[model samples]
Target: MQRLLHSSAPLWASLDKAMLGKLRKKTGYTFSNCKKALEVCGNDIAKAEEWLHEQAKALGWAKANKLEGRATAQGLVGVASDSSCVAMVEVNCETDFVARNKTFRSLVERVAAACLNHGKTLPQDNLTKSFLSADQLKTVPCGKEGGPLADHVALAIGSVGENLSLRRCALLQAPPRSAVHLSGYTHPAENSLGVGPVLCGRYGALVAFKATLDSAPKTQILGRQLCQHIVGMCPERIGDPEKDSPNPDTDSESVLIFQEFLLDVNQTVGNVLEEHDASILDFVRFECGEAC
Candidate 1:
């Protein structure tokens, strides 16, 4: 019976992959989930779709066995920070509507906070083999629950009825002696979430700098401005444009020190920093739905 439905047998076969995909998207259901629904209903499109909502109500998890193939091209970046540490995470979903869900937004916030509390990423001595964000740090605990962060993610998936992914996570910290400003900014969603707190957004950024005595005020201002600049310009660094570089594998788009300044296009970020004697120690940027 199952083979007849899934296979191309004329007895049950009803549509090609294209039509199946269209139905899946229209129903906001995973491919296989939609397929099974279609099969069980004898390839009746409307009946199969009506069955999905019923299944959702009676089910606790969807796409558990098929989430990997789901396209995670929509999501928001989450940011969390404290006096000493900062964290950012890109939590992806299957659609913009899911990204706007309150539960999903809260999940992004909690995961970011988890990353911030997870402690700093390992030192640079072995930088060759490490993930930059909290998603890679397995021991980090979810802020709302006592279990590992991944568990919270799974719980969110069950409730949201979509695939959730922790694409990348990163934590940034300042040196012990100096008080660093860990600034984070989240761009508001298209529609306001209506009071409480905004946990997720279309874009997010984290920029940190070491405070110099007598230069505290200027550096702090610079940090805030840098974050704003990142949100607007999306530069690779505070340096000059690279024209002759032969290494196509190298990435400098997110390097704050190498990119041009948003405030004054004439001056590069590196030039401004040198003039002011301030240094950007570290930074991180995440835009929802960009390549991992």
Candidate 2:
């Protein structure tokens, strides 16, 4: 009787195809991982599921730590904005292929949304600009109920089989009372798959402005044009033309108002602003993989 009881133990613990498929379907983990999880949990489905999540998280962290030191110069810039605020986040990967992946784009979009949400909670004053470093962004909550941003990033790194880094994030806001209009542009602006509103590209910019009169139409057009100019011309600082005269031989493009309009080369950005009765409050430019 003792021998027979011992022999039946093996069959009782055996996991069949149906059980394996069920575990894989529920957890979206690999078949081998599911089987191993079941084996470790003594064929209990509930325990296996919990085990799978634990293992995946651990595996993700291990993979993230292993690949953290790799150089990542290729990735995408993601930007999300609304009437009141705009946010941009830069995520770096090892190759353009990964940068274009749907998962990577989704990750970037989520990060950008998180940044914008964080900014919205602050005092909705005129031109409230904030910057978040990589470490600081990791501690941010991604969604209403989601975990830390770092967990999401680590999972992405594990799934993509590469090193992933959230280099930096920036947010700009102007409430309704501030009478500031915000515009955002992304170069090679491509809509993300399975993600809404956010644009993903190699370069991006955000512009905030206010018009003298209630000329929304003119200000809107010029705001977008300014964003495009910022992305293309790469201005260093918003120089004041009144105080300092434009020098033709110097780094003239480094000044926002001094640079010629990208859409209409005949006039400077300052001239175009004057024509629309708009004045820029603040602007931000992002290039993927630029110096940290």
Candidate 3:
């Protein structure tokens, strides 16, 4: 293979060596693949890099297809928010080690950002919810250059050598001029990317609400507390906290407002909201790798 590669780029041998190293650094492909790309493209660095990406994408899809049925119950939940919109994504892999990988963390972060960006194009006249299935999400443009999100995921799989899945994504948007307050929290928060709007962890929640008389700062504090509470409590739905009668035989914690507030166990979530003159508009909670 080495002899054949050298023979293919005979005149550029010295230059090919330099180009080979450059291609590897630029594409992050295997030595053999990079060398083959250089050989195939006659030592043209630009063409070699492009060839590497195309090949890697193809290889990634092959691997993704082969591993499709394998269980992927370990990964991260990512959340990103602006003033009026919050998006959450759950990306699953086969193990926790990969979940903690920088590449994997970045993938989740980008997915969250993609979801948030997609949310911006929707009408925000009232509290609105949107969901993207894995298939649909893969088709959306992502990254700074706006490549299909699936290409990014595939490239990641090529590098990580794991069956990674974008299990689901949820977007919550509130009217910009409305009194609604939006807040989100990522449990065991990891600022893995250090500078992106996205936060990733094992659990994440986004909550929207309205505060009639609370100060904006206080409302901000209350909103974050509500998000944390939702994450910690594992609320199934924002049931009517004020109207539902608590039954001793059933668990009320599954309902958001009925749960004891994590910030102050002395008061139920409903009580805290009532004290702040706030009412829940909607909420979303995601646990990484949880059953669909």
The candidate that achieves the highest TM-score relative to the unseen native structure: 3
Question: What TM-scores do the predictions have?
Answer: 0.61, 0.83, 0.85
Mind giving the per-residue lDDT tens digits that candidate 2 earns over 1-292? 0010112133424787798899889878776677777777888999998887666667788889999899888999988888898888898999999998877888888888888788788888557888999999999888763788898888788788899998998888887666788888889888766555788899999988877756667666677788999999998888887686676753455788888888988998888889877788889999987874
Q: Which pairs clash (backbone N, Cα, C closer than 3 Å) in model 2? A: none
List the candidate numbers ranked by lDDT, top first.
2, 3, 1
lDDT by residue for model 1 (103-208), tens: 7887777777667666454342211112444345445676545767666666567677778777787666664444556666667633324322324678887887
> What is the lDDT of every predicted structure here?
0.64, 0.82, 0.81
RMSD of each: 12.4, 6.2, 3.5
Clashing residue pairs for model 3: none
Better of 1 and 3 by TM-score: 3
User: TM-score ranking from best to worst?
Assistant: 3, 2, 1
Backbone N/Cα/C clashes per model: 18, 0, 0
**Over the full model, what C-alpha lDDT does candidate 1 score relative to the true structure?**
0.64
lDDT of 2 at 22: 92
Off by over 4 Å in 2: 1-28, 31-52, 212-219, 250-252
Where does the lowest 10-residue lDDT sum fall in candidate 3?
1-10
Candidate 1 lDDT at 225 equals 72
